[model samples]
Target: MSNPAVSNPAASSRRAARAAVAAPPPRPTSAQASPRPVAALSTRVPLGRRVAKKAFPPAVMLAVASLLVGTSVPANALFDPDAPPASMALSSIADAKVAETVEVEGQVIEAEAASDIATTAASRDAWTVTSYAEMLRLRYGSTNYSYNASGTGPIRWPFPFAAPVTSGFGDRVAPCRGCSSYHRGVDFDAGYGAPVGAIADGIVTAVGRSSSFGYRVEIEHIINGQKVMSLYAHLIDNSSVLTVGAPVVAGEIVGAVGDTGLSTGPHLHLEIHVDSVPVDPFAWLVANAG
Candidate 1:
């Protein structure tokens, strides 16, 4: 029992406990975290962003370009170029009408205009073109063309009759004239009942009575794939015995002469046409007749 020198076990135990609690445990070493997944995420996000940035511009440009290209195409087709031009005679039936220009084609079954007008069907379709460029294209195009300026190839008599030509081609309007209009043909004074022969080889295109020319006959001839039509006016009634589509030789008798179709007297009114344009019969006769 020496009270002054003795230590208390509880207090000593408490103090030991306090000291143990106060001392810190050894810290863990600074081990780094595994970075594989984080690096993958970082690379993936950036690549996706970069690819999106690269693709956007080209796609927009392509869309814009397609819109522009669509608007440039022409709405309607025009006539073709690079083909040779065609010519039409001045005396053509087509030339006599409201047509100052004619369009010739390769496969024309009938002349663009005719002495006998259209009766059964509608009138011929006149091309209503918009511009001169289009008109030129029609003239020069392979399928369409302007009337040939030249006369029908090697003009011979539409009907064989002698010529010192009492009357000529052009307007023959006298006050007393019965036909009383632009004479669509030329008058050749031949004897009544003369045997009228075909000028060239042709088909019997038309045969009938006309108001102006009392008895009329028309022939369609082909030369070098061009159409040449001839009209014989003032023929004797019922003289056109040959039916349509009958072939006749040059200088073959087509009809007999008589005063008809507003003729002042018995004579032959001959018209020479090439691609439907009227031309001077005398010049044609001089150039091509035998």
Candidate 2:
């Protein structure tokens, strides 16, 4: 009972080899397996990101911030430790400018004040001079001098010198040839150059050279509402300074005594007139010259 296909051993062996060639390979173990190589990790960073990471230094950053904000940094802040800060230096400069401005303003004010003072002083001086001139003008009367005697009160002495009365007014022998038989005025034995003064406030009516009176000055006054005249005669040559129409006050010097003309010696001849009538001058002097 053997089959024909089973009888050949070589054919059987060849079929076995063909079957082995067609079969799948077996899987490898963990230790014997090969690992795939990972792609090399990239180490290079981007240029833009690298530059952004490197920050600026602190000092440079501060300077840049100041420039951007329009703030100034003093040069000394970097170079000099002893120098003032920027704010302090700015403040000092401002203060100096203000001081200079104040000084200039003060100078201007002082100059103006000085000018005003000078002007005021000049004006005051001018006013003073004008007032003094007016006073002088009012005291001296014009030509045709006349005075109203009403309301006038007492008077002063007529002569500045004190001396004895050598001759009395009224009936007296003539001292010189061609002189009058009656005397009209009293005589005082004052040495030459003795000062004579006005007895009362009055206006000078006459000043002249006369043959009988020599150099004489006449002043008309008002006394107790009555008009009167005072006469000073026998004055030294050129000694009379009064002029007609001038004003005179009591105790004001008019002339000096002399022996000119009909005078017997160096003496002063004083006369008083009431309404142009000669009167005793001694009685009037004693009554008023207390």
Candidate 3:
């Protein structure tokens, strides 16, 4: 044992020299070392793989969703990876259809509206519509299209809009007692009280009532250098205010739709007479009306 106060410089120098020459620490053995943390030695995964779950194709996602919900999925639905969702595809088709319809309608107007607009709705809807591509239907469809277009011609259809024909100009069973089995006029179901118009520039030849026709009106016009007569019957009572021999222009209001004189329902019976012979009113109007 050494005294507490005694200084040992030589001993300290010898101890420092020994420590400097000491052997390096023994390398850690596999068994003696502590095990590494599980997180620190994790297997490397690709960064792209981490984000791939969200990048699955829509079809594949749909199949998986269907399975999760216990719904059967079509086999073809899962195979297509490039196809868009059905809603998106349908929306795109709708947009294309609307665009094409607009273009076709504009072109149709330019082609049909040469001298008058009255001919456009009637002619385009009747004839040229067949020539158009079947897929590109008119935006202003037949039911919605009106015949109110101004006409610079001597003739026009009687109504402001196209009225559906209830009865054709031909032989048919009588609709009511005292009604003629052999039809002489075309019956238009233009709704009750619908305004009737003159088919052409003409003078009122006759206006009266009868047992077969509730209220009748007759007008004579010189069409294409021939005497053409038009008859409107089954008009509402007291609707024909114009007296006999009153001047009327094309599309002049003559009367209103009504059920009278052996009629079953409200409708207009239109007749066309050429050379005192009854002809098909529908055919004559379609051929001659502007």
Clashing pairs in 3: none
Q: Which candidate achieves the best lDDT against the true structure?
A: 3
Backbone clashes in model 2, listed as residue pairs = 149-222
Relative to the unseen true structure, what is the C-alpha lDDT of residue 1 in candidate 2, on a scale of 0 to 100?
A: 86
Q: State every prediction's TM-score relative to the real structure.
A: 0.44, 0.46, 0.48
Candidate 1: segments with Cα more than 4 A from true spot: 1-155, 158-161, 175-181
Q: What lDDT would candidate 1 get against the real structure?
A: 0.66
Residue range 132-209, candidate 2, lDDT tens digits: 435534543222211222223348665543566776666555567876657787787767898887888899998988
Top candidate by TM-score = 3
lDDT of 3: 0.76
Cα error of candidate 1 at position 69, Å: 99
Query: Which regions in candidate 2 have their CA more than 4 angstroms from the true location?
Result: 1-154
**Lowest summed lDDT over 10 consecutive residues: which window, candidate 3?**
135-144
- Say which prediction, candidate 2 or candidate 3, comes out ahead on lDDT: 3
Q: Give the alpha-carbon lDDT of every model.
A: 0.66, 0.74, 0.76
